[model samples]
Target: MARYRFRFVACDEGFLRTFAGSAWRGAFGGALKRVVCAMRLRPCEGCPLAGTCIYPHLFEGRQGADPVRLKSLDRIAVPYVFELDDVVPRSFGAGSEVTVTLTLIGDANRRLARSYP
Candidate 1:
Protein backbone atom coordinates (compact mmCIF):
# COMPACT_ATOMS: atom_id res chain seq x y z
CA MET A 1 0.00 0.00 0.00
CA ALA A 2 1.17 3.49 -0.80
CA ARG A 3 -0.17 7.04 -0.62
CA TYR A 4 0.48 9.96 -2.94
CA ARG A 5 -0.51 13.58 -2.79
CA PHE A 6 -1.19 15.81 -5.79
CA ARG A 7 -1.71 19.52 -5.77
CA PHE A 8 -3.43 21.51 -8.47
CA VAL A 9 -3.34 25.28 -8.77
CA ALA A 10 -5.96 27.10 -10.70
CA CYS A 11 -4.43 28.96 -13.62
CA ASP A 12 -7.60 30.93 -14.07
CA GLU A 13 -10.77 31.64 -12.13
CA GLY A 14 -12.84 28.53 -11.49
CA PHE A 15 -15.77 27.45 -9.38
CA LEU A 16 -15.82 24.21 -7.45
CA ARG A 17 -19.22 23.59 -5.93
CA THR A 18 -19.84 22.14 -2.50
CA PHE A 19 -19.82 18.33 -2.31
CA ALA A 20 -17.74 18.02 -5.45
CA GLY A 21 -16.72 14.43 -4.70
CA SER A 22 -18.68 13.01 -7.60
CA ALA A 23 -17.29 15.55 -9.97
CA TRP A 24 -13.77 14.74 -8.92
CA ARG A 25 -14.35 11.01 -9.18
CA GLY A 26 -15.88 11.31 -12.63
CA ALA A 27 -13.08 13.46 -13.89
CA PHE A 28 -10.41 11.20 -12.47
CA GLY A 29 -12.02 8.05 -13.81
CA GLY A 30 -12.46 9.53 -17.29
CA ALA A 31 -8.90 10.75 -17.41
CA LEU A 32 -7.49 7.48 -16.15
CA LYS A 33 -9.50 5.52 -18.68
CA ARG A 34 -8.26 7.71 -21.46
CA VAL A 35 -4.70 7.19 -20.34
CA VAL A 36 -4.86 3.40 -19.91
CA CYS A 37 -7.47 2.16 -22.33
CA ALA A 38 -5.75 0.61 -25.36
CA MET A 39 -8.81 -0.55 -27.32
CA ARG A 40 -10.82 2.58 -26.58
CA LEU A 41 -13.97 0.56 -26.27
CA ARG A 42 -16.94 2.44 -24.85
CA PRO A 43 -18.63 -0.23 -22.70
CA CYS A 44 -15.48 -2.31 -22.14
CA GLU A 45 -17.58 -5.43 -22.25
CA GLY A 46 -16.26 -8.54 -24.02
CA CYS A 47 -13.01 -6.82 -24.77
CA PRO A 48 -10.12 -9.25 -25.14
CA LEU A 49 -7.96 -7.10 -22.90
CA ALA A 50 -10.52 -6.86 -20.11
CA GLY A 51 -8.70 -9.36 -17.95
CA THR A 52 -5.44 -7.46 -18.00
CA CYS A 53 -6.56 -3.85 -18.41
CA ILE A 54 -6.03 -1.53 -15.49
CA TYR A 55 -8.97 0.72 -16.27
CA PRO A 56 -11.62 -1.94 -15.54
CA HIS A 57 -9.75 -3.10 -12.48
CA LEU A 58 -9.56 0.42 -11.11
CA PHE A 59 -12.83 1.95 -12.24
CA GLU A 60 -15.22 -0.94 -12.88
CA GLY A 61 -14.27 -3.09 -9.87
CA ARG A 62 -13.50 -6.15 -11.96
CA GLN A 63 -12.31 -9.29 -10.24
CA GLY A 64 -9.58 -11.69 -11.23
CA ALA A 65 -10.04 -14.74 -13.41
CA ASP A 66 -9.86 -17.20 -10.57
CA PRO A 67 -12.89 -19.45 -10.61
CA VAL A 68 -12.57 -20.71 -7.07
CA ARG A 69 -13.44 -17.33 -5.65
CA LEU A 70 -16.75 -16.92 -3.91
CA LYS A 71 -19.62 -16.84 -6.35
CA SER A 72 -21.53 -14.50 -4.06
CA LEU A 73 -18.81 -11.89 -4.45
CA ASP A 74 -19.58 -10.15 -7.68
CA ARG A 75 -17.29 -7.15 -7.75
CA ILE A 76 -14.37 -6.16 -5.64
CA ALA A 77 -13.86 -2.69 -4.26
CA VAL A 78 -11.68 -0.29 -6.22
CA PRO A 79 -8.00 -0.45 -5.35
CA TYR A 80 -7.64 3.32 -4.93
CA VAL A 81 -9.42 6.07 -3.00
CA PHE A 82 -9.48 9.84 -3.11
CA GLU A 83 -9.08 11.85 0.07
CA LEU A 84 -10.34 15.42 -0.10
CA ASP A 85 -10.18 18.16 2.44
CA ASP A 86 -12.97 18.40 4.97
CA VAL A 87 -13.60 22.08 4.37
CA VAL A 88 -13.60 22.61 0.62
CA PRO A 89 -14.36 26.10 -0.54
CA ARG A 90 -17.15 26.86 -2.99
CA SER A 91 -14.96 28.61 -5.52
CA PHE A 92 -11.44 29.57 -6.38
CA GLY A 93 -9.72 32.50 -8.03
CA ALA A 94 -6.53 32.53 -10.00
CA GLY A 95 -3.56 30.91 -8.23
CA SER A 96 -5.85 29.11 -5.78
CA GLU A 97 -4.75 25.56 -4.99
CA VAL A 98 -6.30 22.28 -3.94
CA THR A 99 -4.68 19.16 -2.58
CA VAL A 100 -5.98 15.68 -3.22
CA THR A 101 -4.64 12.49 -1.69
CA LEU A 102 -4.67 9.21 -3.57
CA THR A 103 -4.03 5.94 -1.77
CA LEU A 104 -3.24 2.84 -3.76
CA ILE A 105 -4.01 -0.44 -2.04
CA GLY A 106 -2.71 -3.96 -2.61
CA ASP A 107 -1.49 -4.50 -6.14
CA ALA A 108 -2.50 -1.07 -7.32
CA ASN A 109 0.60 0.56 -5.97
CA ARG A 110 2.73 -1.84 -7.94
CA ARG A 111 0.76 -1.47 -11.13
CA LEU A 112 0.64 2.31 -11.15
CA ALA A 113 4.30 2.89 -11.97
CA ARG A 114 4.43 0.17 -14.60
CA SER A 115 1.15 1.16 -16.24
CA TYR A 116 2.37 4.54 -17.40
CA PRO A 117 6.10 4.16 -17.87
Candidate 2:
Protein backbone atom coordinates (compact mmCIF):
# COMPACT_ATOMS: atom_id res chain seq x y z
CA MET A 1 0.00 0.00 0.00
CA ALA A 2 1.41 3.37 -1.01
CA ARG A 3 0.48 6.49 0.93
CA TYR A 4 0.50 10.03 -0.53
CA ARG A 5 1.63 13.51 0.53
CA PHE A 6 -0.69 16.45 -0.40
CA ARG A 7 0.36 20.07 -0.33
CA PHE A 8 -2.81 22.10 -0.73
CA VAL A 9 -1.31 25.53 -1.25
CA ALA A 10 -4.05 27.96 -0.24
CA CYS A 11 -6.89 25.48 -0.15
CA ASP A 12 -8.93 23.84 2.61
CA GLU A 13 -10.32 20.34 3.18
CA GLY A 14 -13.92 21.19 2.40
CA PHE A 15 -13.19 22.20 -1.19
CA LEU A 16 -11.26 19.02 -1.82
CA ARG A 17 -13.98 16.81 -0.35
CA THR A 18 -16.77 18.66 -2.05
CA PHE A 19 -16.30 20.42 -5.38
CA ALA A 20 -13.13 18.69 -6.60
CA GLY A 21 -14.81 15.30 -6.35
CA SER A 22 -16.13 15.76 -9.86
CA ALA A 23 -12.73 16.74 -11.19
CA TRP A 24 -10.17 14.09 -10.31
CA ARG A 25 -9.66 10.55 -9.12
CA GLY A 26 -11.51 10.86 -5.86
CA ALA A 27 -10.39 9.20 -2.63
CA PHE A 28 -11.33 5.65 -3.60
CA GLY A 29 -7.75 4.54 -3.26
CA GLY A 30 -7.05 7.43 -5.60
CA ALA A 31 -3.87 8.50 -7.38
CA LEU A 32 -1.76 11.65 -7.03
CA LYS A 33 -2.73 13.74 -10.06
CA ARG A 34 -1.52 17.19 -11.03
CA VAL A 35 -3.31 20.06 -9.28
CA VAL A 36 -2.96 23.81 -8.85
CA CYS A 37 -4.06 24.04 -5.21
CA ALA A 38 -4.45 27.32 -3.35
CA MET A 39 -5.93 28.21 0.04
CA ARG A 40 -8.63 30.84 -0.30
CA LEU A 41 -10.33 30.67 3.08
CA ARG A 42 -9.23 31.71 6.52
CA PRO A 43 -10.16 30.19 9.91
CA CYS A 44 -11.92 33.39 10.98
CA GLU A 45 -13.59 34.09 7.63
CA GLY A 46 -14.87 32.29 4.51
CA CYS A 47 -16.73 29.23 5.79
CA PRO A 48 -20.26 30.22 6.70
CA LEU A 49 -20.86 27.05 8.71
CA ALA A 50 -17.82 27.60 10.91
CA GLY A 51 -19.95 29.10 13.67
CA THR A 52 -21.80 25.83 14.38
CA CYS A 53 -19.83 23.44 12.25
CA ILE A 54 -18.29 20.34 13.78
CA TYR A 55 -15.37 20.41 11.37
CA PRO A 56 -13.02 20.67 14.34
CA HIS A 57 -14.35 17.40 15.76
CA LEU A 58 -14.40 15.75 12.35
CA PHE A 59 -10.83 16.75 11.53
CA GLU A 60 -7.83 15.91 13.69
CA GLY A 61 -6.15 19.29 14.05
CA ARG A 62 -7.50 22.81 14.45
CA GLN A 63 -7.70 22.77 10.66
CA GLY A 64 -10.04 19.79 11.17
CA ALA A 65 -10.28 16.57 9.10
CA ASP A 66 -12.59 13.58 9.21
CA PRO A 67 -10.47 10.78 10.57
CA VAL A 68 -13.40 8.42 10.85
CA ARG A 69 -14.07 9.21 7.25
CA LEU A 70 -10.42 8.77 6.41
CA LYS A 71 -9.91 5.56 8.40
CA SER A 72 -13.06 4.05 6.97
CA LEU A 73 -11.02 3.11 3.94
CA ASP A 74 -7.36 2.61 3.12
CA ARG A 75 -7.25 6.02 1.39
CA ILE A 76 -8.20 9.65 2.06
CA ALA A 77 -8.67 13.13 0.56
CA VAL A 78 -6.00 14.75 2.68
CA PRO A 79 -5.94 18.57 2.45
CA TYR A 80 -2.93 19.06 4.70
CA VAL A 81 -2.17 22.79 4.37
CA PHE A 82 -4.38 25.82 3.83
CA GLU A 83 -2.71 28.93 2.42
CA LEU A 84 -4.56 32.24 2.12
CA ASP A 85 -3.72 35.34 0.12
CA ASP A 86 -4.41 37.89 2.87
CA VAL A 87 -1.71 36.34 5.00
CA VAL A 88 0.81 36.37 2.19
CA PRO A 89 3.37 39.11 1.71
CA ARG A 90 3.42 40.75 -1.74
CA SER A 91 4.95 38.40 -4.32
CA PHE A 92 4.42 35.50 -1.98
CA GLY A 93 0.68 35.62 -2.59
CA ALA A 94 1.01 35.51 -6.35
CA GLY A 95 3.78 32.93 -6.32
CA SER A 96 2.40 30.66 -3.62
CA GLU A 97 1.14 27.28 -4.78
CA VAL A 98 -0.50 24.18 -3.31
CA THR A 99 1.04 20.76 -3.69
CA VAL A 100 -0.61 17.40 -2.90
CA THR A 101 0.93 13.92 -2.84
CA LEU A 102 -0.97 10.64 -2.83
CA THR A 103 0.32 7.11 -2.47
CA LEU A 104 -1.81 4.66 -4.39
CA ILE A 105 -2.75 1.47 -2.58
CA GLY A 106 -5.10 -0.21 -5.03
CA ASP A 107 -7.87 0.45 -7.56
CA ALA A 108 -6.65 3.96 -8.08
CA ASN A 109 -8.38 6.41 -10.47
CA ARG A 110 -7.57 9.82 -11.93
CA ARG A 111 -9.41 12.67 -13.75
CA LEU A 112 -7.58 15.92 -14.32
CA ALA A 113 -9.33 19.21 -13.63
CA ARG A 114 -8.49 22.47 -15.41
CA SER A 115 -7.11 25.10 -13.08
CA TYR A 116 -4.74 28.04 -13.40
CA PRO A 117 -4.13 30.08 -16.56
Candidate 3:
Protein backbone atom coordinates (compact mmCIF):
# COMPACT_ATOMS: atom_id res chain seq x y z
CA MET A 1 0.00 0.00 0.00
CA ALA A 2 1.14 3.54 -0.68
CA ARG A 3 1.04 6.24 1.94
CA TYR A 4 0.13 9.88 1.30
CA ARG A 5 -0.53 12.52 3.90
CA PHE A 6 -2.36 15.76 4.57
CA ARG A 7 -1.22 18.21 7.21
CA PHE A 8 -3.14 20.97 8.91
CA VAL A 9 -0.82 23.97 8.74
CA ALA A 10 -1.75 27.04 10.64
CA CYS A 11 -0.47 30.37 9.30
CA ASP A 12 -3.10 32.66 10.68
CA GLU A 13 -5.26 31.40 13.51
CA GLY A 14 -7.73 34.27 13.32
CA PHE A 15 -8.48 33.85 9.61
CA LEU A 16 -9.35 30.18 10.10
CA ARG A 17 -12.89 31.03 11.13
CA THR A 18 -13.38 32.20 7.56
CA PHE A 19 -11.88 29.08 6.04
CA ALA A 20 -13.99 26.41 7.77
CA GLY A 21 -17.31 28.02 7.00
CA SER A 22 -19.34 27.31 3.88
CA ALA A 23 -20.16 30.62 2.30
CA TRP A 24 -19.85 32.30 -1.11
CA ARG A 25 -19.35 35.99 -1.73
CA GLY A 26 -18.97 36.24 -5.52
CA ALA A 27 -16.27 36.78 -8.18
CA PHE A 28 -14.43 34.03 -6.35
CA GLY A 29 -15.53 34.48 -2.77
CA GLY A 30 -13.49 35.27 0.35
CA ALA A 31 -9.85 35.61 -0.72
CA LEU A 32 -8.16 34.41 2.44
CA LYS A 33 -10.13 31.17 2.63
CA ARG A 34 -9.63 30.12 -0.97
CA VAL A 35 -5.91 30.72 -0.82
CA VAL A 36 -5.42 28.24 2.01
CA CYS A 37 -7.03 25.15 0.46
CA ALA A 38 -5.01 22.13 1.50
CA MET A 39 -4.31 18.65 0.12
CA ARG A 40 -2.25 15.49 0.51
CA LEU A 41 0.34 14.25 -2.00
CA ARG A 42 1.94 10.89 -2.64
CA PRO A 43 5.65 10.87 -1.95
CA CYS A 44 7.68 9.25 -4.67
CA GLU A 45 9.30 5.98 -3.65
CA GLY A 46 11.51 5.53 -6.72
CA CYS A 47 8.63 6.08 -9.09
CA PRO A 48 9.22 7.38 -12.67
CA LEU A 49 6.55 9.94 -11.91
CA ALA A 50 8.89 11.33 -9.29
CA GLY A 51 10.32 13.82 -11.77
CA THR A 52 6.88 15.37 -11.90
CA CYS A 53 6.09 14.88 -8.22
CA ILE A 54 9.02 14.81 -5.78
CA TYR A 55 12.59 15.67 -4.85
CA PRO A 56 12.95 19.48 -4.76
CA HIS A 57 9.18 19.64 -4.48
CA LEU A 58 8.24 18.68 -8.04
CA PHE A 59 5.21 20.79 -7.35
CA GLU A 60 5.81 24.40 -6.36
CA GLY A 61 4.98 27.34 -8.59
CA ARG A 62 2.55 27.88 -11.51
CA GLN A 63 -0.89 29.25 -12.30
CA GLY A 64 -3.61 27.57 -10.20
CA ALA A 65 -6.27 29.91 -11.57
CA ASP A 66 -6.78 28.57 -15.08
CA PRO A 67 -8.98 25.57 -14.40
CA VAL A 68 -9.82 27.31 -11.13
CA ARG A 69 -9.19 30.86 -10.13
CA LEU A 70 -8.64 32.37 -6.70
CA LYS A 71 -9.04 36.11 -6.45
CA SER A 72 -6.09 37.96 -5.01
CA LEU A 73 -4.77 34.74 -3.57
CA ASP A 74 -1.28 35.58 -4.80
CA ARG A 75 -1.26 38.46 -2.38
CA ILE A 76 -1.30 36.02 0.47
CA ALA A 77 2.11 36.09 2.05
CA VAL A 78 2.55 32.51 3.26
CA PRO A 79 5.88 30.78 3.43
CA TYR A 80 5.68 27.60 1.36
CA VAL A 81 9.11 25.99 1.65
CA PHE A 82 11.05 25.63 4.90
CA GLU A 83 14.50 24.10 4.51
CA LEU A 84 17.30 23.63 7.05
CA ASP A 85 20.81 22.95 5.74
CA ASP A 86 23.45 21.69 8.13
CA VAL A 87 27.05 22.49 7.26
CA VAL A 88 28.41 20.33 10.08
CA PRO A 89 25.69 17.72 10.21
CA ARG A 90 24.13 19.15 13.38
CA SER A 91 27.20 18.20 15.52
CA PHE A 92 28.29 21.79 16.00
CA GLY A 93 26.98 25.35 15.64
CA ALA A 94 23.55 26.47 16.91
CA GLY A 95 21.27 24.87 14.33
CA SER A 96 21.07 24.24 10.61
CA GLU A 97 20.61 27.34 8.48
CA VAL A 98 17.00 27.53 7.43
CA THR A 99 15.83 28.58 3.97
CA VAL A 100 12.20 29.58 3.88
CA THR A 101 10.67 29.53 0.40
CA LEU A 102 7.53 31.33 -0.62
CA THR A 103 5.85 29.45 -3.44
CA LEU A 104 2.57 28.74 -5.18
CA ILE A 105 1.14 25.35 -6.11
CA GLY A 106 0.02 25.21 -9.69
CA ASP A 107 -3.24 23.79 -10.88
CA ALA A 108 -3.22 20.08 -10.07
CA ASN A 109 -0.77 20.91 -7.29
CA ARG A 110 2.08 20.66 -9.70
CA ARG A 111 5.21 22.63 -10.71
CA LEU A 112 8.93 22.01 -10.47
CA ALA A 113 11.02 24.03 -8.08
CA ARG A 114 12.73 26.84 -9.99
CA SER A 115 16.15 26.05 -8.55
CA TYR A 116 17.99 23.96 -11.12
CA PRO A 117 19.52 21.14 -9.18
lDDT of each: 0.75, 0.32, 0.29
TM-score of each: 0.82, 0.21, 0.20
Pick by TM-score: 1 or 2, better one: 1
Q: Model 3 — TM-score against the truth?
A: 0.20
Q: Write the per-residue lDDT of candidate 3 for residues 73-100, one digit (tens) a residue.
A: 4323222432222221223223323222
Those runs of model 3 whose alpha carbons end farther than 4 Å from true positions after fitting are 1-69, 85-109, 113-117
- Highest lDDT model number: 1
Give the candidates in order of lDDT, highest first: 1, 2, 3
Question: What is the RMSD, in Å, between candidate 2 and the native fold over all Cα?
Answer: 14.8
Question: RMSD, model 1, all Cα superposed?
Answer: 2.4
Cα lDDT of model 2 by residue, 1-117, tens digit:
344555445433223333342333333222221121122333424555432233322121222223334454533444332222232222223334644444432222111111212
Q: Which 10 residues in a row give candidate 1 its minimum summed lDDT?
A: 63-72
Per-residue lDDT over 35-60 for candidate 1, one digit per residue giving the tens place of the 0 to 100 score: 88888656778888876777877788
Q: Candidate 1 — which residues are off by over 4 angstroms?
A: 65-72
- Stretches off by above 4 angstroms in model 2 are 6-17, 26-93, 107-117
